[model samples]
Target: MGRGGVPRPTGRGVGVLAAGVLVVLVGWLLQAPALVFAGTTLVVLIVAVTISLLFRTADVRVTRRFTPDRGVAGWSAVETVAVLPRGGRTSGTVRVREQLPFGRLSDAEAAAVLLVPGRASSAVFRHHDLPRGRHRIGPLHVDLVESYGVARRRVVASGVAEFVVVPEVVEVGLGRESRALGDGSRRQREHSLAGGEDDPVTREYRRGDPMRRVHWKATARHGELMVRQEEQHGLPSARVVIAVAAEGWPDARPTLPPTSRVGVRAATAAIPLVSDAFEWAVSFAATVAVEVGHAGSATVLTTPGGTLVARHDPDSTTMFLDDLADLRLDDAPGAPAPAPSPREPVVAVVSGLGRPDLDLLVASRAPGSSAVAVVVTAALPLGAGLTSRPTRPADGRARADDRVLAPDEVAGALRDSGWRVVETDSSVDVGRLITTSGVLDD
Candidate 1:
């Protein structure tokens, strides 16, 4: 390795150099003119090839460009690598190998390229079926090969790029069914505040404040600009609770019998049930958070470790999603935290209604608080080929057979406790499920 680049001798180049030395020694001992000439010519050719490859990769530059710098799960992103040689003309083939996201680059097409000086040579890496997480596509390895493929030089690209694979989000509307029962009473108070001129709430004028809201008497009394603060009336307030406890998640086991391969038993494969369930639950939580933001509700996102106040803005949404991107299932459930304000509706995403989870939901529920529990059970071993078809029990009854299905049991418990429950599997459309459940609509 040198300051410019690392030079590695190819198999053919090493063989040629060894043969040239052996032939030269033999010719010197035998005093043969023709053999000496042949030996010297071979050595010169090898030296020339090494020298050419050494400098070709020294000044080479590589830049990567991602078609939509960010991607989502199950979506395709294209990465284009641009190769340029700074000074001299590149004599041989330039291989641009890229580091791909989510192990998405299994094909050999990401490396095939020829470098043209003064003109950029580009190679495309198509990343498909990306998972929801942060992926780094960077530190390109560029290999410069001689025309005869004898000598090579390696150069690592300077920059490393990052791509965020966010969870899929669907816009959900807050339906009346999703609203808290206290919402009506709160609105009644807001209306009273709006009609009463003597209401005490007042604030300094803001940029978007209407002139009509300016109180001349208050302004004169305060000796500065003042405006009567209007009551909060944009949308019904809602809170989102996300529970990613490992305790509530079911362990994945092999669903099928082991088969023999070459007369030997193969290891049983298990579906990533717990991982899948957690991912689905996170995505569902993110969708609900977005809906709450859109409704202009006071958003409260509760995780196992802590709570985050999410506002209706791009930065807040990005920050929340970024947290979800790195979120994982905790080994044990955290201690009980402060619950959301009882005056607004609440949406909770739990693996299932285990004792702790049920207690938390019950504690958060007020007498008139409208609450929705989204139970994510796609990973549970309920049955074969389960779909997301929500069923209502007759006379608020739970079937005896549903005891095995923990999600169903949780749903029944919630329903009987006077809370709306939405059951979801991996195949369910989160956005559609929320909207169809009438949680986001009036």
Candidate 2:
């Protein structure tokens, strides 16, 4: 269990010992000196080998490195383990086994056998279909076997190491109007000419300021020269809200398509126990956030739990993906949703729309704000089995009878409240939907 090795006899060693005992017993009955000597020699050899192996230690250092450091879900990552012996003398044949999380990798890929290790031996393997989450890799188990395979010693070679698997971000295209909204030129001119006193896009006038550039309204209110700061209006601001509560998603367990690399075991660990609809929602939300960020917009990501990512910088985007990696249904069941930023574009990703969800979307529609709701129409594709009963709230707040609103009803309600709504199912490609649906257009 610790650094010290535990030596034990192999199956061949046990068989030899049993045979030696039987030979000795027969020799005693026959009163033969040569037979007794041979039996005694065999017994002595087995005992000596065991004792030698018990005293000998395989002093080696084992370290593991991951390619790209962080993996992406549904992708492949390479793991390389290097074993270096400390002393000049060669060690016995070594067998290295790395313990992976969730049994995602096969034994043959995770295990390696090396010949006598005089210098160093390294094993490199690729793990496919990486699950999203923080997973621990090691505390390597090393086995040292003698040349004859009579005795073996087992020891823990390395301590545990952890790596993160972030959610996948896909390319999403915005409509022409949506792209124009993100452009800084028109917004810069609007803010420069009509910015109020508290506007961040305007700043105190600097030396040699052009009179035409001065914001007279802000100047009059502040009793000082104020000029429009065109640089501050470079990037637009946007918000993305995703419904994470279990009650908002349907209750159905659908089998993954045959081509999916994620099996049941990996899925159970990587994804929350919620339905496929919820998983699709998370992926789509992540894709929207990244796409908005790429469009020169500072996007904030929020869940019912609260604000998960406040900024759309590279670091914040990474943090947002990390948060989505292990997002669970019961994480923030009854928590209040964060209010959307006023006058900013908002995108809400939801499934099995409920009363609370509708209220949140309706309230997010500010006078100048644009709100879009992407609703998953079906929990999963047709032919994928689904349960007839509704999903009860995991927090036990809602009864089974309080089923979610139908997708058409939810879309109609939002449209009445002056919001654009996009209806999709789990089977549709999120990127394609965003590109062709024209939901982001003005």
Q: Any idea how many clashes model 1 has?
A: 8
C-alpha lDDT (0 to 100) for residue 110 of candidate 1:
46
Clashing pairs in 2: none
Give candidate 2's error at residue 338 in angstroms: 6.3
Which residue pairs clash in candidate 1? 173-440, 174-440, 174-441, 175-439, 175-440, 175-441, 176-441, 180-370
Can you give the lDDT of residue 430 in candidate 2?
77
TM-score of each candidate? 0.63, 0.70
After superposing candidate 1 on the true structure, give the runs of residues whose Cα lies further than 4 Å from its correct spot: 1-56, 84-93, 104-107, 111-120, 150-154, 172-236, 251-274, 304-306, 309-316, 331-339, 352-354, 379-409
Best by TM-score: 2
Instruction: Score each candidate by Cα lDDT.
Output: 0.63, 0.67
Which tens-of-lDDT digit does each residue in 1-442 have in candidate 1?
A: 1134667668888999999988988998999988898999999988887886655543566777877777776678888888776756453466766655345343255476766678777888888876777766766766777778788876777767778877778765553234433354355457657774554567887653445456677888889878767543233456677766554555423222212233224433321223666667777877876766554344556653444423332226776676566655553344444455545677777755445456666677655667778877764455643222222244766554332226677788778988778777766777778767765542
